[model samples]
Target: MSNPNSNFPLTLKQCRVIREIMKKGTEKEASSSLNLSQSSVSRALSQAEQALQVDIFTRGWSGAEPTSAGEVVISSCNSILQAISDTERQLQSNVTTLLKLKTYVEWRHLLIIEAVVKVGSASVAAQTLGMTQPAVSKTLKEIENMVQQPLFSRARRGLIPQTAAKQLASLFLRISPVAQSLQQSLQSLPNELTGRLSVGMLSFSCQDIVPIAFASIFKQHSGIRLQAMQGPYHMLANALRQGEIDCFLGLMRKGPIHPELIELPLLPAQYALIARADHPIHNDAKTLNDLVNERWIVARHGTPIRDYFESLFHSIDNKPPIQALEMLTFASSEELVIHSDAIALLFYDDWNINKLTPRLKQIPIPLPKPECTIGITLHRERQSTIIQTFIEELKLTIIDKLKTQ
Candidate 1:
């Protein structure tokens, strides 16, 4: 393998530096973590910016933030460097030497550095590298010794990769395509295009959208084995971030708009107050306020539907009544609302799709009509080709399902 740090040391180091700066989100923090004098860090960054012919950081008196161009470059580099590590591990295991290059120290360090970013700590990184913590530290020390400069900061907590790491991060991008192709060639190619995909949906969604016909469309790619996971929306979002599942299908709520996740709107839906035909409040209430003080059976707090109701109540000078019941499942929500005085805040489209009983009526309320948009989402950086294909199949299914309705 060609060393990414040889002729391109400056560029590589700059990329690493930018990653640190971006991660720290400030120059002082970046400089401190990089273990470099502020002036040295600034000079190296300046030279790298000139070399790459792009301004990688937006320098202000306060600190530096990654420029738009820098963000793109860093992202590309991160992916490439990860691919290189996977390639190296495969090659070393197989003892194949098609490419020879010096700077093996740098390559090895790059692997650890990437591991730290991926696993989020030295201990986790060590486990991933199949080495003990001390050995990982020693390897890191060797890299700093060879470079004749510290590339990471020692902390009471753990090692912090710096700007030098970011710069090297960028250099790996240039060489990754070759490494990826080799790795792909070396791995026993799967016959019939097989890949395992785990898909998650809200309980209501599973009951509604994910019927036999929906499963059949996804099964069109026999090589793609699809496993369905059902859970509450928040649980599924947590799973998506933790890599338990590849994608999430549900209403988008305002939470941390994780940079790692990308959401695609599938269809628009609206919210309504649903209650049983036999319920006292259904016949008694004419407006939102009349039902405000009444008992409510809602999806647990933090869901999009719950948030909508909360916002609706707040807008009309009322607080949501103490939740007499919390139903994370659509069946529970539908059953409780239809059988008792409990008012249900639910998505109109989902209610229709699930075909709730005729006893349940959607009570109109004069709040800003909040649309519960159903959408598809997946981790932005971790999506596999199979996941993308399944998502497309899912989208087609939804489109057809909605059209038929």
Candidate 2:
């Protein structure tokens, strides 16, 4: 089997040795307790440290002690072991087979299992993992034999994961990003940060704040690589949950979010009603009621902005303009407003106002100031140094730009 670079750098044996040494306070005691030679225990620690690119332990005459980085890694090891034990007990499996799990289960095994469960076909999983279909089937068979349970049920369309397979795949998905983040954090230098930062951006942020933050990050940390994915909010949220993106930038969602993700509110943004600079309605529009008959450009239903737009007219005991164009992007909305008599709603910020002043102008109609907070969302357990630094830069950029406005 080909072993790729895994998010978790250490093997089960290495983690076991390190955990024993941490508990026993010496390699000799750990070796005796685990029925292994001192050199073997030492070798495991050496290999783990090399893979992580950090010194995990400092050896001395008294005993071997875990370094700062080692403590973090050791904690993760303990968590993994505890999770495995919990799974064994929950499944009520044979003690002997479960005990051998640590020896047989590798990161690659978990990767294959996760791929198979996600794609629901051995052949597709094999293609995704750059392996043959037969190799994938063989690995699955080996895993099933080891666990003494069928992980998947054969179906005409595709394979269906059993409860055990789903549980394992979910566990891998949650921990893979966290482990990778930990490794990157340990390997990064204090003065220079290095890693890939994948970000998901909504339409609102793509125009101004996110790009500025990216520029700031690039100037400060040239070693860091940046990727930005733009899509609808629901699609982006799903991507963030699957560990496909580091963080999401846009307007904060209302109500409670997923337990595994955290929302950090940054600044409040107000909305503006905009029209072409030379529109005849510009001078006559003193209230929203005055423009009720005019053509309007608004977001589609189910979007946060769309809800807000409908609520605005309802507050005045009036229905919103029936003659409307449903638009999603500010660029398209601005273009439609410039050529036609369609008034559009947009963010009323200095950056946006300055950009739109040349062709489009904000109407003077009075509207309620609702709290639309702009912020970032991130996985609770996967914060890395690169992600934290980028957030800091983003906060600074928002504050600086707003202050100037």
Candidate 3:
């Protein structure tokens, strides 16, 4: 069974052949180690190189050696294999069993297991996978036999995943993104870049950099499709972890973050309290205490800006304003503040301040400037060319914007 939309360009056997070549440093040694004939190993390497559109190995009298591109591909293969090995260990399986599992497993098997686990019904999974119910059931049974474990249990609602099934499905979910990115990178030509990139945005702070960077990317690479997903930091972070989005742009959080994600700092962020130019509080309020009782518009809870807003009052030994409106959108917050007496805490960059000027003015109260960073968050293992290009554009945009300000 083959899917045209499958993200993995290479088969399991091809990956295994590549891995053995990497470890043995020669096709002959690799074939011997893997118990495969020399012709079979050569064919696997040739097919893998052709599929990826890159020569993974350089052949000579000594043996086959990996090229720079081959190194990257091998690293990705190692990660996928490591994930499988980890899952095997978690299930109390031995090395021999792990090797057998790797040999017998195909990408479709992983996809089927993920589908069945996600939908919890064979019929539904069949429909999702464009297969009949019997086919789905039979494939799942084959997978269970291979693993030597019952992956699911019957229930009135649907099939419930057992511990082994859950672990196996998790392995697929975690490695799928890495494998997809690897394939995209290796298969794409530099001048003809093509792929779909999903970026998650946290609130409006990302507006300053994301739009301009995306525009530059679109102008240069029309073949690439860019999509933006917006939500709070936690939701976006979860989506990034689950591989729903490739990367996120927004204020970086303080404290320990997910181990599987990496945060690259682009610039420092400063927050300011602002009010309408004609508001009475602008003239009467000399300190934060003076505006404590006035209506306020703040970011939604669990956001970095909101945390900073609350901490401002906490530092002064006072509760935050009792009368306040919590908002997530910059437009809504700006409109509410402009039409009413409500004040807001917002990004205080020169670009933002200039945009809000003549209508809204920063409150004169002195505030502490904490160390806050704004940047891109991505999967730790992801090193796709498209993602790198977008990040470069973001950095350039930030530098240019700062220079103008």
Candidate 4:
């Protein structure tokens, strides 16, 4: 295994010195601007070089110029600083850079980094890229040189990501989808569906509506790149408003939306508290308060189901369960209730009578009317041709499937 922290001592002071020298084209001016002695500026460069084991500056009577290695390191440092400034600007005014790679950080370098991290082996990444292992290794080394950090360690079978590598991988993952979307948008043919569509779906929609609707859409459109994210309604709704998700489907919230999301209501949903068929309390006539001490598993706080749960017992002296096990995935919540004594609040679609009902039984607890409002929501300006088509299909699906039910 390799050590990332070992023998790596580059500091912020050294980075400043490098940037100042690059901008000033001489150590004397860098020292003057930084309010430091020339010898201190020179020492900063020397220490950085010693740590990196590479000479980044060329010294002569004409003053110092960055060497080949120094140029790459300087570019990366500038990118890092520029990204930080952009983030601060966005925090204040919500404006961001409209272009990709204005800093010359090559996409190929990012691709190689992604492939290696995902595959965990340079050799496997090489095969996937149709390049030799040594070529991939050489590209990785160039990236390491630019960042001036060790990204990964050698393992018995593959490469293991160190802190630096993991950080880079995170950056690539965050931006890769955007890059692909941009590429598809720019290179698409006229009047054809060729772009990425990210949909945030709820558990109820995932079971039938989204799959059936998307399956039919895929049959008609070959260019629609679909990415579905399923979770609690609140999390998915937030993702839609933040632009992390393009659209949200399932139960819509009754609260007012910021940024003015356009909601397309499809149907109404009912919720019920359920437990394993063999649970000790299934045959009882107890109210929700009667099971106050029992472990209850429910959705995370932002969804309508959770909103209903809170509203149901709001009139009680102190209210419902002291603590409920919140879950994002219905599958996990179902398993938790099936094996343990935990009770789960589920939608009718979630505990379909065909499969899960054999193991789980409803607690016969009557919930309030109109427990949830089901539909699709997206930013008003974000509604596009593909998104509109998806919403229509979802509506058609609910109509067709509900009729059968």
Candidate 2 local lDDT, 1-405, one digit each (tens) = 355445467776787898999888898999998899999998988899888887776542234556556767888788776665565465445434543444456666678889999999999999898888988888888767656677899999899999778766776676566556667766554557655677887775545777788898888887565778677777777777776677887777774257888889877777788889999787998887887788889876766777888888898899977777887677788898999988887664555566565788888887896557777888889899989888888888878886775
Q: Regarding lDDT, does 1 or 3 come out ahead?
A: 3
Query: How accurate locally is residue 336 in candidate 3, as Cα lDDT from 0 to 100?
Result: 82
TM-score of each candidate structure, all chains considered together = 0.50, 0.52, 0.54, 0.51
Question: Which residue pairs in candidate 3 have backbone atoms (N, alpha carbon, C) closer than 3 angstroms, thus clashing?
Answer: none
Best model per TM-score: 3
Candidate 1 regions with alpha-carbon error over 4 angstroms: 1-191, 203-206, 212-214, 232-234, 350-355
lDDT of 3 by residue, 65-124 (tens): 565567678888888888877776676562234334565677777888899999999899
* TM-score of model 3 (CA atoms): 0.54
Q: 89, model 3: CA deviation in Å?
A: 57
> Any idea what lDDT model 3 has?
0.79
lDDT of 1 by residue, 1-405 (tens): 133244342344555566677778776777898787878767877876675566665542224545444555566445554554554443344334442111234455666666665555778888776778886777667755544444567677766766555444444544644333432332333354444566788654435665553466445655344567677766777777876677877776554367778887766777777788676775678877787778877777667777777887788888777755887678878887766767777775753735657888766555586666777778878877777666666666667766765
Which lDDT tens digits does candidate 4 get at residues 1-405? 122112224444566788889888799999998788999999989987886665676542234556545655566556544553443333323223242222334445667788889999998988887778888898798767655556799889879987656655666566444423432333343456644467877764555677888887888775565667676655666767766667877776664366577777777666878899899887764776766677889877766787777776774554766689888776778888889988877675522433454788878766667356677778887777888888788878877876665
* Candidate 3 ranges beyond 4 A from true positions: 1-191
Choose 2 or 3, whichever is better by lDDT. 3
Candidate 2 contains a number of clashing pairs equal to 0
Those runs of model 4 whose alpha carbons end farther than 4 Å from true positions after fitting are 1-191, 202-207, 231-238, 349-356
Give the distance in Å from residue 339's predicted Cα in candidate 1 to where it truly belongs: 2.5
Worst 10 residues of 2 by lDDT: 94-103
* Model 1: per-residue Cα lDDT at residue 264: 78
